[model samples]
Target: MGKKISFVSSKNRGITLDMLVVKDFFRVNDEKVEFKDVVANENAKNSLVKKGNISIRKEYCKNNTDIICVDGSIAGKLSKNAPEGKRVLIATPYDYQFKAINEYDKGAFKKKNTYKNFTHIIVGSPFEKELLKKCYNTPKSEIIDQVCIPYSWRLNQEEFKKKHYDKYCKHYPMLKGKKILAILLTGELDEDEENPYAEVNWNKIFDNLDEDWIILTNSGKLLENMTHIGYQHRNQFVYSNRTFDTREVLSFADCLVTNSGLYATYFAVRQKPIYCLKYTNCEFEKYMKRKFSNLYIKNVEDIDMTKFSEFTSENEKFCEYFSYDCGENPSAKISEIFE
Candidate 1:
């Protein structure tokens, strides 16, 4: 009989995508491997079905499931519920576990050992693995350092353009013959329920941009706020409420300006020109700086707009450092463990 693997993750689209990638790899490579998705979020389930035509299993049983692959530490809670003898594999970044530990330190979790349920943990890099070991004292045997992305491997410029250029041009006709600048800024509500981005100097940032450049963003809130600012280059701004894949927009973009998060990681993996805005002194941001010091811009004033127009060979180095461990086929690497 073949192995029955159950993939699990929270509502996070990125993490869910990771699980789906692994599932897809199994389907293509191993006919004997039977897989099922066990996502709890409706949006995530819908995304899986929409992107891969994958169906979700309402529930999974230990007797039927040979292994439980949990994507991200946020979904680690699922591991505790797995059958006693069932193997649980957790693929996560160090920041997720770091945040959970910080919360646990502040009495958010009742249990002293939150990772007790995990049989093995997969991390992106050796730096991440070392961080986990320092914090959780997790043994080296249980930690696997592998690159984890939604795709089989990082695509070169030619391959990336070939895959997404036509679709992107069709969807965004107005942006044609223009320098596309993609932005992924996360929005958050303040304690008093006021718009957090209202204080930003939107006019200062957009007013200096050339007319030939179009600003593209995924955050609708940012679009709404920037539109209200009535900047000189207001017409050059475009918003994508995730109507299409972000990768499509990124494919043709001359450069990307984003805050520290998964989007930055994705852009880096593509070997594209990117600038990370330092809005806060978060631990993750600090770690990113240590890895790629030149990528960080202090603030809007510090942004060297000329860099966007100039392509450099530095991006290959960034991808090399960022894509350490997992290499081109992290999905296949993980699959080999169970095979």
Candidate 2:
């Protein structure tokens, strides 16, 4: 059916954002999706795509003219001579970054492609749709909101302790008997080059905190010294060597705080209460936090560890805002219900 929808991502490492979206599309086991049959990069098992249960191959994209543009990168991506069957259905977040799709929609940065290509744009929010219409100069009809997001899961905190805690016990047995607080820091070096994380003393932060914490990150530069600080789950202090299950990581986090992942942002907005710090690697996120939602922070200091009600309240509002019913229907978030 639908010629086994072929999903593609721009990168071949870690948990590419697009793969997560595909997972969300399926939402359940009974409702499986025939994702694009791309092979996983040679060394991508630890990557996020693997967590999604999808396989990714190299850039063997035969330009399946019927390619789906999930993210907001311009490039009508569909060629003119390509068979009319080649359609690009993009399942994207509501926000467009630094440059608006408008920049590309208007013809090679010279003219708009709304009239040129048969591109179907699926946005997560209505506000984003409005923005697309304004920027891409496309008709409102072309911009449809499908709240249906990518792979989603309920926080099975119990499952996390059962599966991961023991592994840590072997590395740092001391960590086995303590109440822990987890602070996850998503390294932004890949996106923000100037800020090489060489100065970030993960060792110091953990040492200074009164409570025990297992810091999780993808960057390993500072992990070399986790042992010096009496970190019980020293090895539990994982750097996303390759993007292991993010939700697993998220569930593992008793207390949550992350830089800014589209998934994390979605979690934050839904009242998931992930201490969203100010200024994200992406401009659109900053726009959402500072300008759009109150859950956003100017800095880590802004968060009142004592009163977390603020985050929960904001999440409730986020749930009410769009309802995302536009994305699919009553069951758009059904997986969430079952979980």
lDDT of each: 0.56, 0.44
Report the C-alpha lDDT of model 2 over 133-207, residue by residue, as the tens digit.
555544422444545343322223255346765664454465565533334544355554544334444544544
Whole-model lDDT, model 1: 0.56
User: Highest TM-score, which number?
Assistant: 1
Best by lDDT: 1
1-339, model 1: which lDDT tens digit per residue?
888776654333334545666777788999898776555543445655534322232234323335545433222234335454444454444345445445544556443244444556656544445545544533323666656444424333467566676666677776778887887665344556654455567666666667787778786555556645564565677788668877556546778776645555555555667776654455455644655567776664454555655556565665544545334577766776776
**Per-model TM-score on C-alpha atoms:** 0.69, 0.55
